[model samples]
Target: MSARVAVLGLGAMGLPMATALARIFDVVAFDIAAERVALAVEAGATGVGTVVEACLGTDVVVVGVRDGAQLDALVLGDGGVADSLPTGAVVVVTSTVGEAAVRAVAEALAARGIRCVDAPVSGGPVRAGTGDLLIMVGADDEALAAARPVLDALSSSLTVVGGIGAGQQLKTVNQLLCGIHTAAASEALALAHRLGLDLDACIEVLSQGAAASFMFADRGPRIAAQLRGETPPLRSRLDVIGKDMGIVGDLARQLKVATPVAAAAEQLYRTVAAAGLDASDDSVVATMLAKEPAW
Candidate 1:
């Protein structure tokens, strides 16, 4: 029989991920939002009202929380799912919470004879629904084996980074580049708009040339659309990227690394958040930057 899976926290990423896993496994989904749970059921997965209910008989639990605090609250201490999960069941963390946080959770889960797979994923909602994400994993052989089927169903590229916490470490590195690229893309596109050039043509050219980056390719059109005063759907929110940038900063400080560029990007995200755009799509940064005197 296929490994029974439970997906927790069905937000933007979690919902699509649940849908993808449902295609291959007996997926049970849970979220705080009733609407989200209903949507998961519509996507061919059983919907549970609570984390405990979702993980009761599941072999693997996939968590997609917003940050370390949520992840901790959901799986550790009193009334957490760790107490409810079966011994030897694996918990795959797909959030980009920090290394230390994941390590703490892993250690806690290990004490219960449960396994934790630190697998932070990249790629947006569309890629997630298609099972084409890039997953960075940090776990021992046994734990990895326990979660391999779920991870494989969710990822097109899965790289084993190291022991527990390494996935979060590498994901921090990945977010550093992503955060910086997003800031740079906004700045460059804002400049292009100011230069009286064809923004679409410029984006097309830059995306094909030395200036090319995945952020530019993925978020570029959205940036251009924002320039046209159109509201792009909130695929990735400003606060989400801002939160990742904050994680990058925290990790850099712990390592005592000087990341002036990433720091700058982090500040840019802060500015956008301060402008009350935290709930908006991150592409709105391009719009905010293209304004007069560019904050």
Candidate 2:
């Protein structure tokens, strides 16, 4: 039998994921933004006004909001999903929230006899639409088994990381690497421009060599466009990476581990965000580098 799934938060990633889930399950999608809810509905999802209403009678509830606080509001606040979920239903928290927050939510849901899975995902909206996201799931054996099919419907790669909070722990590491790599790519491109090299050829050659990275290949064109004053499509925002890296910083502090590269990358992103370019694509950081005063 198909699972009855309720997807909350119909944002860039969530909307596409919910739409995919609707194809195989009875999906009721909800969002704080009515426009997003409307979009999901138009994409064949059933739109609901509230999170609680969406979770009602569902076999699994997917919470894809922005952060820990938003996840708490959806699951533990007044008329939250926990309050509305039928007993034995599973609650999947797919936000890129940190480990501690996932632990707290998992414990709270467990008290109410609702299984909770911290299944944070990688890959952006485009991958989510194609059901090719990388899902790092954190749950016990039974919960993992119960949630596997739902996750399989949305992800091309699903890894069952140990227990509660493991998925988020892994995602934190992923964000750290992402921040560092993006910063490195930005710096390399800026240096290439400053050296009076042909920017396109420089990128093409570097991308074919040992210096190449996913961030370089994916964001290189966008970085070049920012240098040329053309805004690229919004894929990943500077503020979003800043937020993720900030979470990584917090995790590092809690674990007493020093992440110097991630710290430097975080500062660059914070600078971009503070300069009122938070909503711009992360490649815009190259613009900041290009405008720096000569020292």
Candidate 3:
């Protein structure tokens, strides 16, 4: 029998994932923005108005919201998942809302006998569209078993980290590394420009050498474009990284760990966000770094 999936939040990541899920499941996608719902229809999902409508007859609910607060509002507020989704339905929280947030959501769902899975994803919208995402899932064995097929359809790599909220904790660490690598890439390329090296050659050579990383290979060309005054299409936005880095900051501070380099990278993203480039692709940090004063 084909599973019925309700996908909430039709943003960059959610739309693609919902579209992909529609291939294997009966999918009804919902978003507050009517325009986004229309887009989901074009992408193969059945679009709906209310979150409650999306939940009707669905066995699994996928949450791909922007942040913790958004997730909370959707699952806990008026007309929310807690009040709407039927008992025994599994709720997969794919938003990278850190540990505490996912934990609270999990606890709430458990109260109503709804299974919750903290399956925070990596890779951007493009990957989500093709089921090439890396999902770190945090759920007890029973919930994981119940949600496995749904997770299988969405991710190439699905690792069960531990009990509820562990996925977000791991994703937080990923953001720390990713933020630092992105910032480090920008810092390097900007320095190459300042040193009068042929930037084309610099990017080419650096990307081939031991200095190359996944972030460098992936974000290098875009960073190169930013250096030349061009804006690349976003795979992930500046404010997304800024927001993610902020999550990292919160987690690190709570753990009392010293993260000097990560802190510096977070500040760079914060600066870019404050300068009104929040909607710009995160590679714009290269431009910010290339400026005389940088950040």
Candidate 4:
């Protein structure tokens, strides 16, 4: 029999992973939002009412919550699923929380002999639904062995970074680059618009040259369209990146890493959030960028 799996949290990223895992396992999904649960059920997985209900007797639990505080509450706080998991069951935390936070959660689960992996992921929701995610994992060999099926089901590119907390550590660096690239891409496109250039042609040329970046290819067109007042597909949310970049900042401060580019990018995300685009897609950063320069 396939490993019985439960996917806790069915938001944008979580829902897609849940649906993809459902194709190969006995997957049950849970979330606070009724609409989200409804969507998961429609996608072929059973939806459960509570986290406890979702994890009861499961072999593995895949967590895809929003941030550290929420992940803490879900795994260690009241009604937390960690307390409910059977010994030997693995918990895979795919949230991009800090290494420190993931270590704390892993240590707690180890006390119960319930293995945990700090596995942060990249690629957006579409890649998640297709099991094409880029997954970075941190776990011992045994725990990794136990979690392999679930990991394989959700990733096209997978690497075991190190033990216990290394995955989140790498993820912090990953977000550092992501934030810088996103901020820079938005600024460049916004500048092009200010110059009255052919937006589509500009994007095409930039993508073909050394100036191109993954963020430019992935978010550039959406940013262009969003500037024209079109609502693009929700691949990533600003509030999510706002939260991720905040983790990156905290890590940088703790380790005394100078991050001028990332700090500047973080500030742009802050300004965008203040303008009420947090719930919108990250491409909405272009809206804030396309305004008159203060200088």
Candidate 5:
């Protein structure tokens, strides 16, 4: 029989990942939002109301919460799934919470004979539904093998970085570049707009040349659209990127590394938040930079 998978936190990434997992496994999904749960059911997963209900009888529990606090609350805190999950069941953590947080949760779960797979994912929500994400894994051999099918189903490029906490570490590195590149893209596009360059053409040229980066390619059009006063759909949220950049900052501080450029980008995200765009798409940062200086 195929392994039964329980997916917790059916938000942007969770909903789509559960949809993909339902195609190959018996997937049970849970989210606080009733609408999201309904959407999960529409995608062929059995939607439950609580974490405990989702965990019971599952061979693997996949968590896609937003942060360490939510991860703790969902897995080990009040009304969490730690006790509900059977011994030897694997918990696949797909969030980008920092390495220390994952390590703490892993240790707690291991005490109950539950295996934890630190497998933080990238590639946004669209690729998640199509099972084409890039997954960075940090788990021992047995735990990795146990979660392999689910990981394979969700990832086009799955890399095992190290054992427990390493995936978060690698993802921190990823977010550092992502945060900086996004800030750079915003500034560049904002400058283009101020200089009377056609943003569409400029993005095309930059994306094909030495200035090309995944972030430039991915967020450039959205930045251009924002400069044109059009609201792009929220593909990546400012708050989420802000959270990731915060994680990068924390890691850099802990390791005593000087990342001046990333620090500047992090500050720009904060400025975007202060401008009352915290809840907006991250592309909105471009608008902030594109404005004429009052001085």
Candidate 6:
């Protein structure tokens, strides 16, 4: 029989993932917001208005919500999916919540006879749309095997990291590096403009040279747009980066690791949020840097 899958929280990432899974499996898409569910339904997914209804008959349930609190509400609260899921159904948590929260959820689900996997993803919305995203999976061999089809639908690269919470651990490292690299890209481009170098030429040369990164290439044009007072369409928002970086900070503290660079980037994102650009694309950090005197 074909696996019945439910994808919850139909946001930018979740909606595309659900659409991709629907192409290969029988999918029930659920979102708290009616409009998002409606949109997914229009895109050929079976939309369910409630989380309970979505999980009732699914073989695998993917929770793509924002953070730990939202995850808790969907899985443990009144009318939650945890109470409604079939005994052997697997719960795939694709949110980038920290290690502690994921582990706790896994334990809770285990008590109720449901398998939980921490399967946080990366590669941004563009990759998500193309089904070429990377999934960092944290589950045992059996759980990994059980979720392989769903993972195949969402990712071109899937790594089965050790055990419960390992995926979130790796994702914390991902956010730390991404936050720092994004800040570094802004600083580099802003410095080039101040030095009277042709900004586009500088980027063209340097991005082809040893200093290039995914962040520099992807955020460069958006940064340039923000400098011209035209914001690019949001792929990842400043607030989302800030939240992920905050999780990194929390993880670093728990592990007693010093993360000065990540902390600095966190401050920049905090400033971006305070400037009321939280809802803007993350590349707007370049605008914040451009406002400084050319020195």
As a TM-score, model 4 comes out at 0.96
As for candidate 6, its clashing pairs are none
**Residue-level lDDT for 86 in candidate 1:** 94
User: Which pairs clash (backbone N, Cα, C closer than 3 Å) in model 5?
Assistant: none
**What lDDT is obtained when candidate 2 is compared to the true structure?**
0.87
lDDT of 6 at 163: 98
lDDT per residue for candidate 6 within 18-74, as digits (tens), equals: 878878888899987899888788777898878888987789998888789888888
Q: Which stretches of candidate 5 lie over 4 Å from their true place?
A: none
Q: CA shift at 31, candidate 1, in angstroms? A: 0.7
Local error of candidate 5 at residue 277 (angstroms): 1.6
Ranking by lDDT: 5, 1, 4, 3, 2, 6
Alpha-carbon runs more than 4 Å astray in model 2:
195-198, 292-295
- For model 4 the local lDDT of residue 194 reads 84
Candidates 1 and 3, the one with greater TM-score:
1
lDDT of each: 0.92, 0.87, 0.89, 0.89, 0.94, 0.86
Candidate 4, superposed: residue stretches over 4 Å from native: 293-295
On the 0 to 100 scale, the lDDT of residue 163 in model 3 is 89
lDDT of 2 by residue, 1-295 (tens): 4678889988768999998887888889999899989898888889989877898789888888878888888889999987999888898888898888889988988899999999999888888987899999889987777777789999999998789999999999988988898999899888887787888898899999999987788889888888878888877878778989999999899889989989999999998899899988899999889876987
lDDT preference between candidates 2 and 5, better one: 5
Q: Give the local distance difference test score of model 3.
A: 0.89
Better of 1 and 3 by lDDT: 1
Higher-lDDT candidate among 4 and 5?
Answer: 5
